[model samples]
Target: MNQIIIFDFDGTLADTLDAVVRITNRLSGEFGYLPTNPETLSQIQNLSSWQIIQQSGISLFKLPFLLKRVISELNQDLQLIHLFPTIPEIIQQLQKKNYTLYIITSNSKINVITILSRYNLVNSFKNVYSGISLFGKHKIINQLLNQENIEPQQVIYIGDETRDINAAKQAKIKSIAVSWGYNSAEILLQHHPDALIAHPSELIAVIEQIKNPIG
Candidate 1:
């Protein structure tokens, strides 16, 4: 069977936590809420803006305005987006192996495209799926499975958070959780992903193992 590999953009392919923290805290200040510290912000890195607000005790009445403002600001700050270390090499290796690659992200389409283009990695992916709504990984994954004619057993989803693992499970695809992203090893391990990778290089070995597993 042919293999397809899908990746989550923000925390998995790019180091976006710094940008997320900056934007979240800026929005919190704008909404008259206490600014979140880096440590606190790190813990909620996997959540969407609405989810973060709810988890952080922000009132529902202020959420809509705050979310809109934050998203607008983030869109304007695209210059700050960056690819994670060694990601280009990883993409090159996967391409060399003839692995079908795609990106399934919660980020808006424009932002995902712009960032990938900026990093010159846009051509590495055969397709990019961006979710219109927050926390839309599951929906995107389902779409890819049906629209792209990819079977669950022939695909692997690589991501940073427990939510990504759950999304892959919901889509019936194998999942690999990366420890170097937003969520720690402990949090990702709780989801019991098919594998866990600590560095970009380890991903190649994981994919090889998946392609040739022992009975």
Candidate 2:
């Protein structure tokens, strides 16, 4: 089997943070929360995923319904969204190298696939595990290892959040945190990922070094 590369959808692969903010503000009236402004968003970006949610003033009991509505909203907006810079080319390069790509996202599967299709990237990834809970990515990571009969050493989890680093740690897989995602680089660094990459162009070299480190 090809070496696997698992990705997080929202902030990692798809540049949906801005869209999320817009949607969140739009839903604030119906959901009865304050609109998140850029200043608030900047502060939220320093916190972990779960922490951000807690700060949202949405109780855990109602989070599922809120997420349902958010996912539905995102479904309609996915195509309008874009990937991080140079991501499409990088993914194509990875595909050419025969890496088995998989996506684990809190977003709906249809939403993930829809946007990939827009970029002519639907076939670049082998599978997408969608609708993962905010704090439950480790469980899905474990499930992916089991379901795919994959060895942990042959896999790397690449994502943009502190929670992704935590999940990779829990799953005992190497993690690379991209600086351009949901959390600031400083905050993500505090979480201690195996590596921190600053750009899409740096990814291949970093992965190669990780896979075949020089003595």
Candidate 3:
């Protein structure tokens, strides 16, 4: 069977920190709360928006209103969103190797599609699963495994958070932690993923190593 690679969209595939921080702090100011400092915000980059709100002690009642406003602003800024440097080349190389790729994200499907389209990467992925239920990645991975008849051993999951590592473990698939994304290297290292990649180009080598283990 062909090997499969699944990616986390926001922090792993796209460099969306600037837009996320800008909108988050803007909403914080509007709600009369002090904005999170860049250093602190950087640490939580892997967290979903709702997770951020919960961790920040924002009242649940106000969260819906604030999130709606922030998302509205983000939608308009999609065109300006930046892709991680070398990501396009990396994807191209992976595609050339006939690797089946997919995206699993907490983001809405519309947003994910839009971003992928903007980068001309819409056709690269075989499918996408997004806006899933809270803590949905493990479930999604299970479904993908069943539907595609893919063995856990033949799959690799790449993501930027501790939760992602946990989810991959729950699904019994190999996991790769990306240091260039949301969580710090220390935080991700605590999860002890199958591999940790600090650069986009490193992914190709990691996948190759996994597929062809040395004696």
Candidate 4:
């Protein structure tokens, strides 16, 4: 069976921190949360998503509604979003190597497709699963594993957040945390993912190492 690589979209593939921070601040007033400033934004990178949520004072009960609104708002400016430098080539190289790639994200399917299409990456992935709950990625990951009849050891989840690492752990799969996203390298290291990659091209070596460990 072909090995599967599950990816988180927002920070892992797309450089969405600027867009997300802008959108969140714009919607903060109506959502009844404190807005983040440039300094606060830097601090947020040091914290996990859940920790940032707690600091923002946003009610947990209001997340689904807020998430829906954020997605709708972000979709309007799909042109403003972009993938990180070298990400497209990295993805293409991985696909060329016959790896089965999949993306699981909390963003809307429409938005993800729009961005992927913009970068000519729409067909690179075997599947793109979106609209995942903020804290429910583990469930989605587990479902994919069972649906594909793939073993946890045969899969690796690459993401840029602490929650992603935790979810991968819960699903019993290896986690590769990337630093060029919402979470800083220091914060990601604290989460203790199986591998920590700082550049897009490094992914190739990491995957190879996982598939064939030094013995």
Candidate 2 global Cα RMSD:
1.4
Weakest 10 consecutive residues, lDDT, candidate 1?
Answer: 44-53
Write the residue-wise lDDT of candidate 4 on 1-215 in tens digits: 68889999999998888887788889898888988888998899999889988998998888788888888888887888999999999999999999999999999888898999988899999888775488899998887788878898889899999999999999999999999999999999998999999999899999999887898
State in Å the error of residue 198, model 3: 1.0
Q: Judge candidate 3 at residue 124 and give its lDDT.
A: 92
The sequence of per-residue lDDT tens digits that candidate 2 reaches over residues 84-184 is: 87899999999989899999998999888888888899999888987548778999999888998999999999999998999999999999999888899
Report the candidate with higher TM-score, 1 versus 4. 4
Model 2, which residues run further than 4 Å from truth?
none
lDDT of 4 at 111: 89
lDDT of 4 at 114: 90
Listing every candidate in turn, what is its Cα RMSD in Å to the true structure after a full C-alpha superposition? 2.8, 1.4, 3.0, 1.0
Candidate 2 C-alpha error for residue 51, in Å: 2.2
The candidate 3 region of ten consecutive residues with least summed lDDT is: 43-52
lDDT by residue (68-107, candidate 3, tens digit) is: 6666677777887767899988988899999999888766
Model 3, residue 206: C-alpha shift (Å): 0.9
Q: Which scores greater on lDDT, model 1 or model 4?
A: 4
How does each model score on TM-score? 0.87, 0.95, 0.85, 0.97
TM-score rank, highest first?
A: 4, 2, 1, 3
